[model samples]
Structure formats: structure tokens, C-alpha cells
Target: MHENVRTLLDTLELEKLEENLFRGTSPDNGWQRVFGGQVVAQALVAAQNTVAQDRHVHSLHGYFIRPGDPTIPIVYEVARLRDGGSFTTRVVTGIQHGEAIFTLSASFQRPEKGLEHQATMPKVPGPDDIIGQEELTTRILESAPDAVRHYWMRPRPIEFRPVSFEHYLTGDKLPPAQNVWVRCLSDIGDDPKLNAAVLAYLSDMTLLDTSLFAHGMSIFDRRVQAASLDHAMWFHRPFRVSEWLLYTQDSPSSSGGRGLTRGSLFSADGTLVASVAQEGLIRLRQKSQPDV
Candidate 1:
């Protein structure tokens, strides 16, 4: 495993506190707020740890209640909502400093054959045709804003190979759409729940950015204040993090300071593995008055 992925797996291995509680800590990456993805993934891990191994996560609905504090540890409390012959449900609440910071409800199911169908994957350049992470980061940083560059240069559990960097390369107010090829930098063994948690982590990576494409802005844009409000995901088929997956995303609407975006993940062989949707608060900041 790559050092970064190893660090992430270590972060996900929550420490059991009570029968239904676990504690998780963040790596000292120097961010004031914890990455939303990490908390989602860790909460999923905590919930799965409390359930039978035969069940695999099929869907999750989550809400980000408050910004997480990276310097402090988070406590995840899991409640068993239901247990059926084939399906199980769990609700996980992430608490920090005695307040709820995030929450998720995940439903799991045993393996069973079923009729399946999916939309055809969009035709796009494959991973081999895209610029690798090191080169892409170097290219973008030449003119990227401080926040964007900082995020790109940092060592992450996965590497993003965007289909195109046109929007960032130039401040173009293009359509609200994006395509990026992504995968974990390394393997974390063959634990199915682990894979699901990792997927949950990745699902939050760029959905908000896509929502900003139409407005010609980004999370890096100092004039914009953006944060996820809620996130939802559904697992349709088995997937692996060690292999490339295409994340095709687009924003259908952005108005009233809230934007909604959706995406689908397809394996290299064109099987749709999962789907994700999120809405975020994307308020434009009022420009500061010029100093007198």
C-alpha cells in the first residue's frame, strides 16, 4: 500500500469505546477543518464494525451538520435500526466536543443475484490518455489559486486524473459537468466493508466542484463559500478501489445559494458500480469594502 493509503486505512480503523461507540482521529495534515470524506468513511467503518460481516453496505444517506475539527478526535455512535433476514440498517452519529457534527444511515444486504441494468458509460479518454497526478498538480499550480494548489499538492489516499482541466487551466464559465478517473493509491486487503467505506470517502471529493462549474467558480475561489449540506450514495455492484473508476458528474441546478449535483461511477469494463448525489451551500461572499 502507498504510504498515504496506509495512513487513511489506519485512520479508518476506529477504536472501540463502548458497545456502540468508537473513536477516530485525523492525521495531522494541517487543515483547520477535517475533510468531510474522512468522517463519512470512518462513520461507515464504525457502523459496519458493529454488524455481522455477511452484510455489505448497499446504500447510505448522510448529512454534514457542522465543520469537523481536525485537531480533535471524533466519537461515532451507532444505533441498530433494523435487522432482517436479508437486510440490516444502522444509523451513525458523529460527535465532537459533545455536539453532533455528522450523521449517516447505512443499509446493508447479503449477496443475492438480481436483475441488473445500467446506463452506458460515457465515451471518454481512459486513464492511459490522461496526465498523471504529479504532472497535473504541477501544471495547475502554475496559475492555481492558493487553496486549489494546496489541495492538489497534498499527498492523498487516491490520485485524480481529470478528463480535462480546462476550467482550472482557464477561468472558463463552461457547462456544469466533469469527468475524472480516480482510484486509491494502494490496496487495503479484501474487506468488502472497507472498500465501501473507501468509496464513501471518495464520493465526496468533487461533487461540490461540479456544482460550481456553471457559475465559473470553485471552492478555491475566495469569493465563494461552499460546503456540503447532505450526501447520498447507493452501491449497485461490487467495486475495487485499487482499480481505476470513472467518476462522471454534472450539476443540474444551482440557485438560491444551494446547488445540487449527481454522479455515477463506472468500472473500466463499463459496469456501473455506484451512484452519488449531494446538495451544498454555495453562497457567494460579499466583497469586503475597500479600506478607508
Candidate 2:
């Protein structure tokens, strides 16, 4: 595993507290607040620990109530909502400073045969055909805003390669859709819970930004304020984190200072492994600063 991925795995392995409580800490990634995906993934891990071993996470819904303090530990308290023969539900609240900063509800299911069908994967160039970060950075610098360029080029555990790079340049309103290829920097093994947790971690990478594409804006725009409000995901099939997955995303609406975006993850062979939906705070700052 990459050094960062190893760190991430350790971060996910929350410290057990009381029977129903766990504690998690943020990695020193130098961000002001904890990453939304990290909290979501950690909360899911907390929920998974309380669930039966035979059950696998099938869906999760979460809301970001407050910004996380990366400097301190987050306490996750799990509530066993319901446990049935085939499904188990858990509600997790990530607490910091004795207040609720994040909350989630996850459902797990036992293995069972069922009819299945999914939308066909869109036609796009494979990951190998796309220009990755190193090559793209050289080109992005010439046209992208300084802050936007830097944010997009910076190192991250997940490699996010957008098929359409125009949105990061000028604010020429384009379609509210994009396709990106994403995967872990190194293999994190085949543990099912770990695979699901890693997928949850990556799901929050860029959905909200895609919502701003039609308005010629980006989360990096200082004039525009943005934060994820809620996130929802459904795991349709099992998949490995080491392999490339295509994240196809689109924004269906943006109004009342919020933007809604949905994304689908497809394996190399085109099997839709997961679906995600999120809404974010995307209002413009009153006294506009640099939009970079």
C-alpha cells in the first residue's frame, strides 16, 4: 500500500470505546476541516463494526451537521436501529466537542440471490487513454486560475482524472455532467468492509463541483462558498478498490443556495457497482473575493 493509503487504513480502524461508541481521528492532510468523505467513511466503519459479520453494507445516508475539527478526535456513537433476518440498520453520530458534527444511517444485508439490471455504462475513453495529472497539470496551468490549478494538481490518495477539463478553466457554462476515472494509489486488499469504506471515501471527492459546471463556477472559487450538506450511496455490487472505476456524474438542479448531484461508479467491464447522490451549500459570497 502507498504510505498514504496505509495511513488511511489506520485512520479507518477507529479506536473502540464503550460497547456502542468508537473514536476516530483525522489524518494530517493540512486541510482546515475534516474531509466530508473521511467522516462518512469512518462513520460507516463504526456502523459496520456493530453489525453482524455476515451482513454487507448495501446503502448509507449521511448529513454533515457541522465542520469537523481536524485537530481533535471524533467520537462516533452507533445506534442499532433495527436487525432482521436479512437486513440490519445502524445510525451513527460523529461527535466533536460534545456536539454532533456529522450523522449517518447505514443498512446492511446478508447475501441473497436477486434479479438485477442497471443502465448501460456511457461510452468514454478508458483510463489508460486519458491524460493523467502529471501531463494534465502542465496544460492546466496555462489556462486555469492559480488557486484552481493548484487545488486540482495537488497530490491526493485517490487519483481523480476528469474526462472533460474545460470546467476547470474559464466559466463558460457547459453541460452539468462529467466523467472521471478514480482508484486508490495502491491496493488496500480485498476485505469487503474495507472495500466499501474506501469506495465511500472516494465518493465525496468531486460530486458537488460537477453541480457548478453549468454556471461556470467551481468549489475553488473564493467568491463561491461550498460545502457538502448530505450524501447518499447505494452499493449494487462488490468491487475492489485497486482497480479503476469510472465515476459518471451529473447535476440535476441548483436552487435555494444548494446544488444536487448524482454519480454512478462502473467497473472496467461496465458493471455499475454503486450509485451516489449529494446536495451541497453552493452560495456565492456576499463581498466577492477572487473567484479562484
Candidate 3:
């Protein structure tokens, strides 16, 4: 397995401190705060450990209460809310420094037959046709901004091939939508719970950036203050994170210093495996005045 992927898996494996409590740590990569996705994934893991193995997570809703301090460990407290014949519910709270930093509620259900329908996947070039992140970074290394360059240069567990690189290159005000092909760098075994957690982690990657498309800005822009306020995901079908999946995203509205974005994750074969919705803080910072 790729070292980064192994690291990611290790990060997701929380230590069972008690029956309903778990502890997780963050990678000491140079980040000011913990990634929101990591907290979400870890919290899900905590909840999953408490539920029966026969049940699989079908949906999760989370809120970011405070910025997490990456230097310390986060303690997750899971509350077993209900355990019906076919469904189970768990609520998890991520705590750090004696305060709550994040909270998530997840629902798990047993497999059962049901009527289902999904929207057709958009027709777009396959992942192989699009430029990979490494090559794209090398192509614009000298010209790209430091933030953008650093982002592409970082070693990530997941890889992405975007449908278009024009927005990142030119910062042109474009439509508030994007499509990116994503997959784990290494094959994570077909564990339903693990795959669901990984999917939740990947869902947060570019959803917020979709909102910035209309403003010709990106989260990397120093003038923009970006943070995920809340995240919600619904697992519609089983999916393997190791395989390429198309992440189609769009921002429907941006107002009151917040932007709402929605996303769908489709397997390479065009199966809609999951849906995600998130609203984030996208306030712009005022430029400083030049010294007199």
C-alpha cells in the first residue's frame, strides 16, 4: 500500500480508550489546524466501532463547532442513541482542550431491498484523459502561486484529475460547478464501513472550492477566509475508494458570508454511490492599507 494511504488508514484507526470513547491523533504535517474531514472520518470510526458489524452507515450529518488543534489528540465520545431491528443511530462528539470541536450523528441500517433511482452521470472525459496533479504541478511550477504549488506538491492519500484546469490557471469567473475524478492512491480493502469513512473524507476535498468558482477565487487565495461550517453525506450504494469516482459538485447560492454546495459521487461505471451537501464560511478579508 502507498505510504500516504497507510498513514491515512492509521489515522482513521482510533484507540479505544473506553467502551464509548476513542482517541485519535493528527499527522504533524504543517497545518495550522486539523482538517475537518479527518475529524468527521474519525468520529464516524468511533461511532462504527460501537455499532453492530452487520449494520452499515447510510448517512451522517456533522457540524464544526470550533477549530481543532492539530498538536493534541481528539477524544471522541459516542452515544448509542437507538438500536432498532433494522436501523441503528449513534451520535459522536469530538473533544479537545476540554471543549467540543466537532459533532456528528450517523445512521446505520441493515441491507434490504428497496426501490431506487439515480440521476445519470454527466458525460465527460475519463480520468486517463485528464492531466494528473503531479504533471499539472510541474507544468505550471514556476508560474503558479506558492499556495497552489504547495497544495499540488503535497503527498495525499487520494488523487484527483479535474475535468478542467482553466479556473485554477486563470482565476476566471466561471460557472459554479466542477467535476473531478478521485481515487485512493492505494487499494483499501473492501470494508464497507471503512469505505464509507473514506468517502466522507474525500467529499470535503473540493466541495468548498466549487463555491469560489463564481468569484474567480479559491481557498488558497490569502484574501479569502474559507471553512466548512457543516457537512452531510448519504451513502446510496456500496463503493470502493480505491477505484476512480467522479465527484460532480455545484454551488447553488452564496450569501451572508456563507456558500452552499452540493456534490454527487459516481463510480466509474456511472453508479451514484453517495451524495453530499455542505455550507461553508467564505468571507473575504479587507486589504490592509499601505503605510503612510
Candidate 4:
């Protein structure tokens, strides 16, 4: 297994500190702050630990209250909101420095028959057809800015194969949409809860960047101050993170210093397995005082 993937799995395996409390740490990857997805995944894991094994998470909503300090361990406190006949609800708060940095509300449901319907998966080329991140970096990073180049060169647990590279290459302000193939670098097992946690982690990778597509900008751009404000996900079917999934994303609107983006995850066989939505801060700084 890839070392990065191993690290991610270990990170998600939160240590139990009390009956309804858990602790998790972020990898020392030299980032200024902890990634939002990591907190979301850890919160999910914390919630899952307190729930019945028979139930699986169907939906989760989370808010980013403050930037997480990666240098310290985050303590997750889980609150058992309700345990009903068919549904169980849990609320998790991630604390650091005695303050809440993140909060998540997840609902788990026991398997049962229900109406089946989903939006049609968009027709797109397979993962094998799209160029992987490595090739994209080797081909384009030489002339890219330091920030952009550094971001692409870093090792990650999840791999991305975007269907189109024009935005990154030419900086054309095109449509606010894109399709990228994503998968874990190694097998994360078949446990539904584990897979769901990993899926939640991967969901935050590039969804917010879709909002910048129309402006021919990216979160890596130094002029843009970007951060996820809130995230929500709904799992429609069982999925394995190790397998390839097409992440179709679009930004329906951007205004008032915020952008709203939506995404759908489809299995290799075109099964709609999950959906995600996020709103992020996209404040652009003036060029004169770039450091501010």
C-alpha cells in the first residue's frame, strides 16, 4: 500500500479517549492549517464509532467554524442526538485549543427498500483516456508559478485524472464545470463506514476549485483567499474508494465573495453512488498588498 494512503487510513482511525470522545491528528505535510476534508472524515469516524454497526451513514452536513491548527491533536466530541427505529443521528464537534473548529451532523439508516432514481450520469471518457496528474505536472509545471507547481508536485493519497486540462494550461475562462477521475492510491477495505469516511475525505479535494474555473483562477493562486465554509454529502449506494469514480462538478453561482459548487460521484460502471455540495470563500486580494 502507498505510504500516503496508509497514513490517511491511520489518521482516520481515531483513538478513543472516552465513551463518546475521540482524538485524531493530521499528517505533518507542512501545510499552514489542517485540511477541511480530514476533519470531516475524522468526525464521521467518531460518529460511526458510537453508532450501531447495522446502520450506515446516508447523509452528513458539516460546517467549518475556524481554521484548524495542524500542530496539535484535535479532539472530537460526539453527541448521540437520537436513536430511533430506522434512523440514528449523531452530532460531532472537533475542538482544538478549547474552541470548536468544525461541526458535523450525520444520520445513519438501516438498509431498507425504497424508491430508486438518480440523475443520469454524464457521458464522458473513461479514466484510462484522461491524462493523469503526473503527466500534467511534468508537461506544464515548468513554467507555472511557484504556488501552482508546488501544489501539483506534492504526493497525495488520492489520484486525479481530469478529463480536460485546458483551464490549467491555458487559463481560459470557460464554463464553470469539469469532470475528473478520482480514486484512492490503495485499497481501503470494503467496510461501508470506512469507505464512506474515505469518500468524505476525497470529496473536498477539487470541488471548490470548480467555482474558480469560470474566472480562470484556482485556490492555489496567491491572490485568491479561498476556504470551504460548509460541506454536505449524501451517499446513495455502497462504493469502494480504491475503485475509479468520476467526479462531475459544476459551479452554479458565484457572488458576494462566495461560490457554491455541486458534485456527483459515479462508479466506473456509471452508478451514481454519492453527491456533494459546498460553498467557499473566494475573496481576491489586490495585487499591491499581496501579502495582506
lDDT of each: 0.89, 0.92, 0.92, 0.92
Clashes per candidate (backbone, < 3 Å): 0, 0, 0, 0
- What is the C-alpha lDDT profile of model 4 across 171-195, one tens digit per residue? 6788999999999999878999999
- Give each model a TM-score: 0.96, 0.96, 0.96, 0.96
Tens-digit lDDT string for candidate 3 (1-292)? 9999988999999999999999999998889999999999999999999999999999999999999999999999999999999999999999999999999999999999999899999999999988887678767655888887777778889998889876676678999999999999999989999999888888899889999989999899888888999999999998899999999999999998899999999999999999999999998876763211
Q: Judged by lDDT against the true structure, how good is candidate 3?
A: 0.92
Model 1, position 280, has a per-residue lDDT of 92
Candidate 4 lands at a TM-score of 0.96
Assess the local accuracy of residue 104 in candidate 4 as a C-alpha lDDT between 0 and 100: 99
The whole-model C-alpha lDDT of candidate 4 against the native structure comes to 0.92
